[model samples]
Target: MSLASQVGAVATRTFREKLGPEILEVFDKSYKNFTDVQVLSGTHLLNNHDVVVESPTGSGKTLSFVLPLLRILQNSPEIQKNQEIGAIILSPSRELCNQIVSVIKPFGEKLNLSVETVTGGQKVEKNVKMFKNRGVNILVATPGRLFQIIQHEKTLISRCLKSVQLLIIDEADRFNEIQFEDHMREILSCIPKQRRTGLFSATQVKEDDDLVVFGLRNAKQVKCAQERNSAAPSTLKNYFTVCEAEEKTSILLEFIRQKTDKKFLLFFPACNSVRYFQKIFERCLTKRPLFAVHGKCSNSHRAAQIKGFSDSSNGVMISTDVMARGIDISDIDWVIQYDLPKHSSWFVHRAGRTARLNNCHMSRFLDKHEKVKLEEVKVPTHTSLKSEELRQKMIKIQVSDRAILEAGTRAFVSHIESYSKHDCHIICALDDLNICGLANAYALLRLPKMRELTNRKDLDQFERSSIETSEIKYLDPKLEKQRGEIMKEKHEKKVEVLAAKEKKRREKEQRKMKRFGGGRGGRGGNLKKNENLKRKRSEDEDDTENDIRLLKKIKRGKLSKKEIKNVL
Candidate 1:
C-alpha cells in the first residue's frame, strides 16, 4: 500500500514477464522495475498501437520505447536480415541519437539485433556504407542526417525503410522546431503507414500540434501521473541568485571552488561563448578538468570530450544546447546556467541534466535585470557572495595573447546577439542588458564592435584597453609571423593602387593640354589661343558695363530712346 511497496509490487509485474528473455536478462542485472511510463507504454505498443507519451526527466522514457521496439523487431517476420531495417528511431541531436543507441545496444547484442546511428558531424558517405556492409535492424538517427542519407542513397535507404515495422521519435517536441520539421516530414513519408509509431518527450504535446504528421492512428496518449506537471524530477533542487553581469564569472568561480570534487555542466547561449569560456574556466579552474561541446566541434572531438568527462568521476563541461537534451552523464552534481536559453522551455531541459536518476542541484545566476523573468518559474532565492567576495578577478586573465583577446570579443558579441533573441523576451530583453558589464564578465580587453553597443551612452562604465587590439600578437610565433606577412601584403597592394590612380590623373591632364596645344601649333600658338580667349572675355565685360551706365542715366532723366532700347 505504501510507495516503496507499490514500486516493489509493480516491479514484479513489469519487465520480467512481458519482455523477451534476452531483454529480461539484461534488465534483471540493473533495473529493479520499469517506471509507470515504461510499463503503460509497453502495454500499448505490444498491442501494435501508436502511442504519445509525455513524461518527466529520469522517468525511463528511452527504455519505454526501446523495450517495445526490440520485441516488435524480434517477432517481425517481414524483416530480412542484412538487407532491411526493422525499426527507425529519430532523435533531435547527435548526442541524443548516440544516447538512444547506447540504451538499445546492450539489448541488441543479446538478441542478435544490429543497431547503427546516423547523425551530423560525421561523413554521410560513412553512414551510407553502414547500410551496405551490415544489417542495421534498428537505426537511431538525427532527422537531418537521416534525411541527408535518404537524399544521397535514396534507393538503398528507402528500400531498407520500406520494411520498417516500428518508428520511434525520441524527444518528439524538438522535431517541431523549425530546423528539424521538414526533415521529419520527409522521413515520415518514406516510412510505411502500417507501422507502430511512438512520440516521447519531457514536455507535453498538444492535440493540434504539427507532430500529428508522425501519423498517429488512434494513438493512445500516455501521461505519467507522478511527474506529469513537472519537467524535472522530484529530486532536483533549484536555487537562483540575482547579480550584476560583471560579477557572474566571479560568483561562478566561487561556486566551483566550494565544490571542486563534484561534476558540473555550465550552459552558455552559443558555440563561440562555449569555446571562449572553456578557455577562461581552464585558466581559472586549473585544478578541475574542463571540456567543451558545441555544434562546431568535430564528431570525434565532441564524442571524445564527452567520453573523457564521463570516464572521470568529476569534471566540468562548458556547452551550448547541443548537450542539453537526452544526454545521460551520470553523477553530475550541478548544472550552472551562465546565460538563459534562447527559449524558456529549454530552461527545464538544462536543469534536467542533473538530478537524473539521483539527487542533484541546479544554480541559476540571473542578471539583475532578468530577476523579474523568473516570476512565473518561481525558483527559490539562494545566498550569494558578499560584495567583497564578488571582486573583479577577470582582469587577471591573460588577454595579451591575441587568441584569447579575440575569443573573448567574439564570445561577448555572440552572447549579446543570442540574448536579444530569447523567447522569454520580457525577462531577457536586449534593452536591459549592460553591454559594458557583460564585456567585463567575459573578461574582454576591449568592447567588440557590435550593433548593441553602437552609439550607446552607458558604455562610459567600460574602460577601453589602451593597448590597440590590432597591436596584440598571437601567442604562437608562427601565427604571428604569418599575420605580419598578410598585413605587409595588404599594405603593398594599397600602395600600388594609389600609385596607379596618380598616374591616371597625370595622363588625363596631359591629354587635354595636348589636344588644345596641337590645334594651335605648339607654345606660341597656345599663347595666342589664350590671348584670344581673354580678349573675347574683355569685350563681353565692356558691353555689359556700357549697358548698365546707359540704363542708370535714363533713370536719372538724361533721356535717350537708344538707352531705353538698349535696356529693353
Candidate 2:
C-alpha cells in the first residue's frame, strides 16, 4: 500500500485502539488550530518526506509533527522481536530528550513497541547495554553523548541503529544557538539519508538557511496560526525590573516568599549563578523545599531533583537553560528569568517550560539592559564553519607567541596577552620570527590570522573595519587598576556586611537568651549564684549546730544551772 494509505490505516487503528472519542476530539480541535502553512506541511510529512516545522512556542507544533510521525511509525511493518533500532530522535538537551521520550513512550508502549532513551549526565554504559541486551526500537538521545557512544562503540551503535528508518531532531533551533550544529551534523552524517527525517522547532527565524542545507532542504515548512493580538498567550506575562547586582538575591527571596504555593522556576544564565542563587534561597527560605538543576550537577542528583519536583505538589526549581527544552512538569505556575536568555530562542524555551500542554503560566523577569539586549538578539542559524577554505584562511592568519613578543608588535603582544591563552594558537611556523610577526600583526588588525577562519569572508568592509579597531586595542593599565580597585572595594564591602551581619546575629542570640531566663541560675547568673549558695549553706549549717547546742544546754539547765553555765 502507498505510504499515505498506510498512515491513514494506522491512524484509524490508533484512534480505535488507543484514543477515545474525547481524545480524538481534542486532537481534531488541535489540528484545526494549525495554520494553513502547518496543515500543508503536515500533509507533506504524512506523505513521508523530510520537513522542518517552524513555529513559535505554545503553537501546538510538537503535536503537529509528533502525531504524524506516530501515525507513520504505527503503520510501518512490525520488526521481529529483539531487533535493531527503528527510529532515533535527537534533542539538544538531556531534559528535552527525556521529555520527548516521556511523551512518546506511553503511546509506543500502548502500541506494544519498545522505546528507550539515552541522554548525557547518566551512565552511558548502562543505556548502551540496555539497548543492546533488550531491544530498543525507538531511541531518544542527546547529540553529544549519542555521538560519543557511537564513536566509542561504533559496532554497537551501528548494529543497533543501522536499521533506523526514521530520525527526528527536536528543538532544532538550539542546534545553532548552543553551537551544537557540528555535532548534530556529524550525527546526521552517521545516519542514512534515506531514513525519514523531521526537524521541529518553536521560534525559527527566516535566516535559518543552514537548517535547510542540513536536512530541511527538501523538507516541508509549517507555521502556526497567528493570534488575535501579536502577543503570546495571555497566560504568559513579561515583566522587567532594574536592580543592583547585589539586590538580586533579595529580590528573588521576596518573589519566592510572595509566591509560596506556586510552582516556580528561576532561570539563571550560568551554572555559577544557579549555585549562588541556590545557596541564597537556602538561607532566605529555610522552610521551603527548593531544588536546583544544572549541567554541573551529577546525573543522580539532577535526576533525583527533577523527580522530586515532578512528584511534589509545590516546590521551586532554579536552573539554567539545561532544563529549558526537554523537561516537562505540570502546573509550573511561574518562570522567573533571574538572568536574561543569551538568545531569543532560549527565552522562548525557558518560558516554554511553563504553560506546557496549554496548562500553567509563564513570566519572564529581565533587567532594563537585558530588555534592550533582547530587542537586538536573534537566534543563530544551523550553519557549518567546517569548510576547507575557511580553515585555510584561519591557518594563514594564525599567530605565534615569539612574533607577538617582538618589540614593534607591542600592541599585538598586549592584545594576545589580554585574551585567553586558548584563543591564541601557533598556527604555522615554529621557528620563523617574521612569519609569526606578520601573523600577530594580522591578528592585531583583526584580519584573518593563521588559523582557519570560517565565515569571516562575508563581513562587509564597514564591519571588518569596526572589528579591526575594536579587537586590536592595547590593554589599558589604568582600566586594569580600576578593575582591581573595584574588586578590592567589593571584597571590603562584603567583609563589612558580613561583620555587621555577625553582630546582629550575636545580638539576636543575646535577646533570645534573656527571654528564656539566661544561664540556669535564675536572677543571680552562674558565678554569683554559685558563690552565694556556698556561703548560705555554710551559715545555715553553723546556725543549726548552735541551735542544737543551745537546746542541749536548756535541757541540762533543769538539772543544774551551774553545770549548764560550765557546759555553755
Candidate 3:
C-alpha cells in the first residue's frame, strides 16, 4: 500500500501549508487538529533546516518534526529507490519509540514509507534480518541499541545512516543529561554533517551542553506557550497534601478513590515500590485495576502494560522513573510523583504526562516532601512562554470544586485507623533556601493534622530555616554515630594486631636466649641472658630518646629543612 502521488506541489504555498494535504487528511482522520507549533516546526524541517522545539507536553511536538520529515521522505526519489533510509528518530525508551511508531506506522504504511524501531530491548538478530531483506525509510531507535547495531552491522549502518538526511531527538532535555551525552555525541558523530536536526522536549534548561553537541546551527526555536509558574503546562493544577511520611501510601489510595472518574499515572521511586503499589491497588475495588512498568519488567511486559493503560478507558499505570522521561499517553488526568525527584527539573517531565494537548491543562499531586523540593526548584525562566502567564500557583489552591466539598463532607474513607493521640497532627512546614540575598518564602502548604504542637499556636512558631534544615537532617542524617563506631573498631583491630606481633617477637627473643644458653643451663648463663635483655632495652630507649632530641632540635631551629630530613 503506497501513494504514487507527489506531496505539497501547491503554488507558492506558505511554510505551514507545505505539510501536504495528505498529512492534514490523516490528522483529521485521527481527530487531531494540527496546531501552529506543528506547522511552523514542520515547515522548517521540510526546508532542510534545524530546529530546537521547547513546546509544552501534549502539544503535538512529535508530529511537528515527524510529519515534515515524513513528507520529505515520501517525495524524495532516493526514498522511493529501495526505500533508502532518509530519517533517523531517537528517543530515550522503547515505550516512547513504540508510541511514535504508532503514529508514523499507520500513516507510513499508507504512504508506502517503512519505519522500523530498533531498541535495546528487542533482538538485534530480527532487526538484522529485517534490514537485510528490506530498506527502512525511517529508523527510530534508542542510542545504545543503535550503536550496538552500528558496531556489528556495517552493511546496515552504511545503507541506512551514510545517506540519512534528518535526525530527531525527542525529549531533548533528557537526552542532553550527563547520562546520555556520550552516546548522543557518538550517534551525532556517525550522522552526516549536512543533515537537518531537531531537538524537541517539554522541559528544557538553557545551559544544557546537549544542545551544543546536537550540532544545531541557526535552528528555529519553536515553543508552545502555557500559562503556569512551573515549566509544566499551565493547564496542570498543582497541589500538595501534608501527611506523615508513612501515610503516603494510604494517601495515594484515598487520592485514587477521589479521582475514580479520571485516569491516573503514578510515579514511584523504585521498581519495588511500583510493584508494591500495584499489588496493593490490585486488592482494592479500584474503578480500574493497576498496571506497572519498571526495569525489572520484561520489554514485552512493559509494552503490554503501557498498551493496556493507553487502551483502557480508566486505569492506573504505576511505574518508576523509567516511564518519566518521554512518553505520551492520552487521558492521563493526574500525575502523582510517588516520591520527590532527585532533580527538580524532573517535575516538569513527570507533570508533562498529564493535561496533554492543553486538555484543560492537567493535575499534579505531591506530598509534603516533594512539594517542599518543588518549591525550592529553580529553572532559569528562559522559555518563550509569556511572562505574565507564570503567576504563582503555589500560594493559591487549585483543586476541583468537588474535591473541596468532598473534603468538607469527608466523602472518602480515612487512610488508616488511629488508636493513639500521640503523633496525632500533621504539621505544615515552610522551607526558605536563602541563596544569596534573593531568598523569598513563596509556597505554603496546609497539613491535615492536629491544631498546634504543644502550644506553638500556628505555623509561625517554626522558623523557615529550622524546618528546612530539619528536613535535610531527617532525609539524610550526618551518620556521625556510625562513623565513630567504624573508626573505633578499626583502631582496636590495629592495636590488637600490633600487640600480638610485639608479644610474638618478645617470645621469639626469649626462645633464642634459651637456645643460646651453651654448656649447661646454669645460673651464669641465666645471668648473661638477663644482662643481654637489659642492654637491648636500654639501647632501644636511647634510640627513641635520640629521635625525640632530633625532633626538639628541629622545632628549636637547630636543623635546616634538608638537615631535618637527614636527622629523621
Candidate 4:
C-alpha cells in the first residue's frame, strides 16, 4: 500500500476512537477514510495546539482542520449552542465561504451545532439581523463581510467571538497577499488571542513566511508528503497541448466532444473570456448544460450558476480563478485550462478542483510562443491540431451575432492584457504572443483599439470580417433594437456635449483675441514682448549681482579667472 493510503487507514482508526458518535456516524456515511494531511493535522488540533497545515490541493485540507475543530467544540464544556461562537472559518471568496458553510452546516446540524455564514453577496442588514436574532455557534465568513460586521456591530459580534475556541484561516496563502493582509490583521485582532488558530493552505509554507501577522503560538506545522513533490493531488493526471492562439477554442471543443459524459470545469485568466466562451459553448454544445461565472458576476448570478452547475450530472462551468480554491464539487471528470494562470499556485488550485473524491484529469492549452518546459514537469502532450470545421463554425457564429462579435473582441483584448501580467514572464512573454493568430482564434470581427496591438505588422496579413461592424445585428431583435436606440441617444448626447465645448472654446478664444487687440500677431507679439522684457530684466539682475560680487572681490583683493573673463 502507498504511504497516503496507509496514512488514511491510520487516520480512520484514530477518528473512530476519538470523534463523537454522531460525527463518526456521518463520517462513515460520507467519507471512506480520513486523508494523510487530516490525520497529521488533526492530532495537533485535537490536543488544542495551534497548527499550520501545508498540503497539496485535494489532499483533504478542509476536513483536516474542520473535523478536529468540530470535535473540540463538541467536547468543550464551556460551549453553548446558538448563544456563542465556538469556531470561525475565514475564507477569501464568497463562493469559498458558501462552500465551507455547506460542508460544515450539515455536520454542525448532525452535532446540534448552529452554523451561520456572512458573505458579500447578501445584504448586510439581513446578515446583521440574522446574527442578532438567529444567533450562531460556528460562523463561516469571507474576511470583507466579517470585518464589516465587526467594524459596525462590534459589541455583539466581538462578544460572540470572545467565546470562539477555534479560528481557521482557510487558504492562508491568499490572506498573505497584500490585498487581504490588512483585513486578516483586523479580523485576527478581533478574535480572542486565547483561541486555537489553524492556518491551512494548498501551497507549501516556508519556515519563514508572511503568516507572522496571524501570530501562531509554537504552531505545529503539518505538511503532507506527496509523490514527485507535486502541489496537486497524486491521482490527478496533468496534460498540456501546444497550439497557436486561434486553435485553442477548436481544440477545447474537440476535447469536450470526445468526453461528452464527463463534467468539466474550464478556467480562463479573465472574466470576459469566461463570459464569451460560455456563450459560444452554449450555442455550439447544445445538449450539454452550460454555466459561466467569474469575479465580475453579481452575487445572485454567481450563486445561481454555482448551484446550477453543482446540481448538474454532466455540465461545463467556465470560470476565472475565483472557483479555484475551497470549492468542494464532487465527480468533476476534467479541468480544462484555456489560458495559463497568472500564478503557478493557481494552476495547482485549478487542477485540484477535480480528483477530489476520485482520480481525474486536467489539461492546459499553451500558446506556441510560451516556452514552458512540459517535459520537465512530465505533463503529457495532446498532439492533435485545431479542427477546420469548428473554426468555420466559430467564424459563422461571430459574423452573425453582434453580441458574440463584441464579446470576442473584448475577450481577445482582455486576454492580451491578462497574459502580459503573468508571473512567469520568462515562460509566457507578452512580446512572443502571436497577436494575429490569437485574434483569429477569438474570431474577432476587427482588431480592438488596444495599446498592445499598436504598430503590429502581422495584423495586415490576417483576414478580418467582410461585414461592417455597424451592420452586424444581435440575434435577438428586441436586443438589437434597444442597442440601436441607446447608441443613437448616446451619439446625440455626445454631439451636444461636443458642440457646448466648442462654443466655450470659441468664447474663450474671442476673449483672448479681444484682450490682445484682435489678431493672431497681436497675441504673438505681446507674448514675444513679455519674453524680451523678462529676459532683459533677468540679464540686468545678473549684471547687478556681478557688479556687487566684483566690488566684494576688490575689497578682499582676490578675483577668479572665470569671473574676470565674464566681466570682460
**Highest TM-score scorer:** 1
TM-score computed on alpha carbons, candidate 3: 0.59
Candidate of highest lDDT: 4
Q: All candidates: CA RMSD in angstroms?
A: 14.1, 26.7, 17.7, 15.5
TM-score, candidate 2, is 0.55
Better by TM-score, candidate 2 or 1: 1
When sorted by TM-score, best at the front, the candidate numbers are: 1, 4, 3, 2
Model 1 spans > 4 angstroms off = 1-16, 80-83, 225-232, 353-398, 451-461, 504-568
Residues 405-497, model 1: lDDT tens digits: 777778888999998887666556678788877777776767767776677888888887665466678898998999878866654554456
lDDT per residue for candidate 3 within 1-568, as digits (tens), equals: 1111122323224743676777667766874445555666777777777888776766677777878887888778777686677889998888788889988986787788888899977788887776677677888898878777767786666555777888998887777666787777667777788888988887664664557788887877766564122234555565555433323444455566665577888875556455534544565534676788987788889888888888877688888777786576756787776545445456677777552111011122323322312222112322222211211221121121222222311211111111111121222121221211111111112222433223333435323332221111111134545544554565455445655665676678667656665446667768777678778867855765665565455445555545644543
lDDT of 2 by residue, 457-544 (tens): 4323312223222122224567546655664565455445655665675567556445544466555466665566556657755765
TM-score for all models, in order of appearance: 0.80, 0.55, 0.59, 0.76
Regions more than 4 Å wrong, model 4: 1-5, 8-16, 226-232, 298-314, 353-392, 451-463, 486-568
Candidate 1, residue 299: Cα displacement in angstroms equals 2.7
Per-residue lDDT value at 39 in model 4? 74
